[model samples]
Target: MSVYNQPRRRVIQMIMIGMILLIVARLFVLQVVEKKYAKLADANAVSRKVVYPSRGIIFDRKGKSILGNDAMYDLVVIPANAKNIDTAYLCQILNIDKEEYKKRMLTAILKNGRVRQSVFAPLLPPEVFGRLQESMYLFQPGFELVQRQIRSYPYAAAASILGYIGEISPQLLDNEAYKAYQMGDYLGLTGLEKTYENVLMGQRGIQYLVKDNLNRPQGPYENGEFDSAAVAGKNLRLSLDIELQVLGENLMKNKIGSIVAIDPTTGGILAMVSSPTFDPNLLTGSYRSANFSRLYQDTTKPLFNRALQARYPPGSTFKPMIALVALDEGVITPSYGYPCGGAYYGCSRPIRCTHSGGGHAANLRLALANSCNSYFSHVYRLSVDAQKFGGIKIGGMQKWADYMHAFGFGHRIGVDVPGENGGLIPDSAFYNRRYKGSWNSCTSVFLGIGQGEVLLTPLQMANAMCIVANKGYYYIPHFVRSIDNDDTDLLAKYKEKHVVAHISDSAYQTVINGMTDVIERGTGRKAAIEGVRVGGKTGTAENKAIINGVLTAQKDHSMFVAFAPADNPKIAIAVVVENAGFGATYAAPIASLMMEKYLKDSIPAKRNPVVKFLLEANTIPPAMQQKSKLDSLNRKAAATLKNGAGGRTFR
Candidate 1:
């Protein structure tokens, strides 16, 4: 009986000892290892504050900060600390009643649980901030003014490309990636801001301060040993030419279209204008929400970045790519010729040519220069229906689609900006899905002429021009030229060279020579610049839209793609004007003016008339805007381009 009692006593003793150890370990963790509860404990006699660093500045090629930061104030409140203060005067300064103040206090309590701080009044206007600063101490520890840096665009241009920032949403706060961010924190919403958020958002700092019984900050806790300094966001240098951007925006004023210009040598975007752009300042500071609501509801869609999103047909601009594919596949030679009285009879429906009598389709370069529809249609049939590819279904069509992919189609080209759309490039599988596996190349023959089943963003067209300009290789189009005070992998991918499949240099020359002729003596003659060789292609993309439950044939979208100083190509540009009559009429001239500006640094004074007429032209369909919807800010900018010569011919 004694032995059994001893064993039970030992077991009870061991259990008691184990429970005591567990309790001790938890106490140790709460006291030292984990700082969460320690901070809570510190809250009684200490104030922990967050210090936000200034956001990175965005500079153009000239080192001018087009997208910069301007200091603003936020009124922060800790619900538990708010006591025995002038609630009425505070409300009066904020222009809110007692009920509204109570409502805000309740909201702050719910957000931060009565202990932590939350934003009460954010992005205060200059006058309100001045009034509040005069008597802020009267509010005691419950409220404080915090200085924050908000974005400012001095040029007030590139709204779509620079993008906007807004307070973090509850959805974003719940995300694991954003767990560290508070509810009132702002984050990039679109464009380059969204794309480079990680680098642009610097590290936040924490400071611990001793507080008096009245909740006033007495001094640094433990002599400031625990405080962390804030780190400023890394700055970025862009390839964008803001002056060029402004000019493009001015020319694209009162229109529905896009202009994408790139440095063909480096694949750096020189200027990108999504017409109907609003002032970037509209999306900043205290008025951001109200201004955004207005812009979002506008009929012209001033917020949309058309340069990287609009999916318009490449039109005759695609003829050169077709010629490249044909030349690469051994289906056609540089000297290949066809006899076309007026139309191509090979397909079920006749495809008409601009040049009817005969010699238009006489050779590859000649056909390209003339933009003969019959010639490219015949070449498309020959490549897809050729025996070497085992006919269209077996291999040919997919190969053609492969070439299209190599040219940066059918997928995002990964430009440094966000919201880029990979426009449609109908492959065999696509045809198989749409036509259920029973269709011929002629069924999509218009694709050969850049009219059917092939849609591309202006950026894609511009990038394709870079590929042509570089002969076979291209760098991904990007806005950032360099990152300042940083050694990171931020720009690594943009630095890589993307090479298309090996194609003969001679084949590229043939296509390039024809494009040069296009500016010299063909459809794109208007695109030529004095003493500078130019290569250009004009396009008229047929379009249709649904209106009141009816599919109506809208006016063709005028388009043009070009490369300047043709031999040693410096710039490549693509301009698209929606609902504009002919490519040569609107798009060609727009591209021409832009190219001239980029190459000569200014449009020759002689071409002032054409620039003036285009600047004042309103090409947006009447249905899109019954009256001009151009914002007053942009209208003022556009007015700068109005001081030129009189009206001139479109071509």
Candidate 2:
């Protein structure tokens, strides 16, 4: 009887212990794991706000800040706490009607839950900020003015390169990559900003504020304990020459064109300019939203970065590449010559040569110097229809396309900047698709002169020059030279040497000699510098576009590509002037001026007259110029922007 009673007592003891353990576990979950009560308590005595760090500054090669931050304020609200507030006065300061105010408030509530903050009015004008700061107490814990930063361009150049920032979009917020972002957070929307967003965005910090019974914050809660400091974004150093960028922009003004300059040694972009560019300062602070729409819809299309976006036939500037391919394939030697009587008679439709005289195509260098269309057209036929590869049927067209691909055509170069267009590079497969597999080499002979179906962006053309300048290897073109305290591997790819085609050194040297001759005694005479040896090519690319549903030849686009100090090449450039007639006229002179300016650091007094003429040269068509609205917009908004947007100055 005693043993049985002891076993029953042990069972009773185990039951009691189990009940106590369950009670303790439930208490731990309620006190530590859950936050409902903690939030309720926090609402009563403390307020939490985000402290955004200053965005990264972008500096040119000369250590001048091209893009920097400016102090601004955002009026934010917590929907659940914004009760019995002066909505009417708030709308008045925001310069919005009551209906618009209601729409924003509802949007804020729906985007963020009732507890978190959403931007009520962002990047406020200085006058509005001052008024809101004075009346902030009336809104109590519901609303507050939080300090933030907006981007400013000190040089007011490179608008397309530096890009702009805007509130995180609805689509981005839903992605896993952007999970840390809230509804009102700002991020880079385009260009370099969008490319290096992670490095430039910085880490956001949270600060807890102590508040009184009336829900007014007195000061920091607990002397800043439990607060995290905001880490400012790392500064970015770029290879851009600020002065060169400005000069390029000025040179292309009132004209539809683009210019891209590169450092051949490293593939760092020196200056990239698209004509009709506006001040980058226009896309910052309070007026950003309004100004963006106008700039986007402007008649001249200033927002488009034609240097990296627009597609154009390389024209005669492409002849060098063609010659290289021919020489690389053993189809032609440096001394190979062609007989020309103005036009190439090999194709069914004769292709006319700019140089119709005899002996102009006597040799490779002479033919290149003369830019003989008949010579290059023959070379293209020989390369693609070579009997060694069983002609175009077996591997000829594909081999040519492969060489083009190795030279960075028909694909994204994976530049640091986003939105690079991979211009078309036709292959046998492409022609098969287009011509249903019945095309012949002569049928596409126009490609030999960089016309017909061939198209290329200015960046790609500029990169092609770098290949010739570097003798066979190239680095990926990029803006970022270095980042302050950078811990990531973002720039590793740009630093790697990308070697292409095993063509002999002799071939490259021969071509370089011909291109150098172009500046010395050929069509690119305008590209010659006083003391420096420059190699260049001039292109009068025929322009054809659909006009009223018909593909019409409107006018020729002027193009020039050059590399300076050919013996020790440092800078390479490509310039494209739309509808500006012959390449030797506008494009060659522009490239020549830039080369001179960079090599000497200033155009000598002798060239000042040439500069003046180009600066005043109005190349824009009369009808298109009449339709442009930028002149009126600049006149009206320039003064207003300087005074209204955060009251900060742009230099």
Candidate 3:
């Protein structure tokens, strides 16, 4: 019985030892090595909550808070844990009907599943939050309140520039760029907010809580070791001057236009006012959707950003640029003369001059000051027909287009904002495409006077003024001066200087002198300010719009461009008042007042009447106002916003 029995005993012993080891290993894995099973078992009782970090604070140049945060609460729910809660009572606290409650619940479930937390009701007002806070315990683990920050404007201004934040859309959620963002996250929709979203949206944090059988939160899961802390976004310091912006907006009231003022030294935008603008607060808080729809549908298009996007003929305000180009091209010298006895008879179709006298067209300086339509028309014809570049085909039109591009025309200026429209500057190819090279400089002679196919945004016009002020170069215009704690290469582009034109300083001086005379002795005389030698040009851009399938002549758009202290220019501004009769009537005075307000900080006592007139002037034609509901809607919204903010009455 000996050997066989011993082997069998040994086999049995080894098998028993292996079984014992397996049992010990399994127990160790369940208790320590593999935590997955334990976590799964604890899944029903655990809630992972998102802690949204406060968005970055936006401050004006003077450190005044333009956009700030107000504390709010978002009622989030983990549907899996929402069992015994009183649905009726929860809806009452949330101020929603039963059907709405069901809709939100269904949305939450479909969004991230029943176990994950989803926003039930977001951005509760302080009063609503207070009411809900008192009865929060009744909602238990299924519904918990998470702190959030909604935007608030101290000065309800610059709605277009500041932009607004909104909940992430489904398309954005699926976008690769927004992969890091969750569905309930808020992102900037437009303006500077949209441009600097990455810098403004801080890192989100997460916290885990444990719930009991009744879905009531017991305490923190894993004693809060796994929780992450939220980091507040970086603060942005803008280049905007609060007072200047407010004043510009005020002056633009009851008008349809834009005011773009830039600091020529740095290309920083001091104030950009798109008339018919609404309160920025309208796009914040709970009323954002309704108000946004109203704004989008309004006939006047207050939501449209005119300064950066609206393209219009530069009118006589473009004469200086043409003069500069002509002087630089040697097509016309500073002393070149063109005889114009009220009308330029050189062209087949004689062009009429606004100035009746022929003496003013004797030289470029006098011609520019007078804005002699005949002189500029002659200059344009000569430049395009010059012997060097073959007439309007071989290289003439192309060269002219090149000059325009050098002045920051016909392309994006790379502004640090979203939705910048590059105004059109046509080349020979464009004309050839349309006319098969049949077009001569005479056919497109309107280019000389800033009419025809020429178009420019108020931003481009303002930048052109900056270029003229800076002599030959400019910084790419930007809203934010700098970003706090920024190490990334975000603002590198704005810091670089761009040399658009290389004309000599003397040529610029001659142009400047002409512009100065314009303010002192010519049409822009209304723009002259005492003690400050301002150089400006007044423009009455002809307005023609197609109505009922017929081209109708409308009121001319009033425009003016100016730079102060002529020698060491500080601010360069462009103002456009649509449907106004003449440039001097509305645009020039507004520009003058703005310059005075910025440089002198107050309008002189003598000019108080002018201020009163401008403030009270209703440039918007009554017929247009009657046809379009935009002005009324804007007024009502402004009144509501002013009253709500506890500010002074709508300016």
Judging by lDDT against the true structure, name the best candidate.
2
Which regions of candidate 2 fall more than 4 Å away from where they truly are?
A: 1-43, 113-115, 635-651
Between 1 and 2, whose lDDT is larger?
2
TM-score of structure candidate 3: 0.90
Local accuracy of candidate 1 as per-residue lDDT tens digits, 1-651:
688699899999999999999999999999989876786576678767788888888999888888777778889988898899999899999999999999999988877679877889988877889998888778968898887878867787888988988888778988998887887777888988888787788988888878776556778887777789889888889999999999998898888899999998888999999988887776777767766777787889888889988898899999999999999989889999999888889978777765669887789888888899888888998888888989999998988889999999989999988888999998888999999987997898988889878889999999999999899989999999998888888788888999997888888999999999888888899888889999989998899889899989988899999998899999999999999878998889888888888888888789989988998898877766865444653444334324320001000
Using TM-score as the measure, the top candidate is 2
lDDT of each: 0.85, 0.87, 0.86
How good is model 1 by TM-score? 0.90
In the range 341-389, model 2's lDDT, one tens digit per residue, is 9789997777776566689888899888989988998899899999998
Task: State the lDDT of candidate 3 residue by residue for 1-651, as single tens digits.
Answer: 788699899999999999999999999999799875687466777777788898999999989998888776778888998888789987887778999988999999998789877888877766778988877767886888888777877677898899988888778888999999876778898998898999999999988888776555678888886689999999999999988999899999889999999999998999999988887877777667877887888767888999989999999999999888888888878899888888877768777766775588788778878888888887887887777997777888889899999999999998887889999998888898989868888778988888989999999999999999988899898889989999888888888888865688888988999999998888899999989999999898989999999999998999999999899999999999999978899999999988989898887799989989988988877765666665555565567666664221222
Q: What is the lDDT of candidate 2?
A: 0.87
TM-score (C-alpha, index-matched) for candidate 2? 0.93
By summed lDDT, the worst window of 10 consecutive residues in model 1 runs over 642-651
Between prediction 2 and prediction 3, the one with superior lDDT is 2
State the local distance difference test value for candidate 1.
0.85
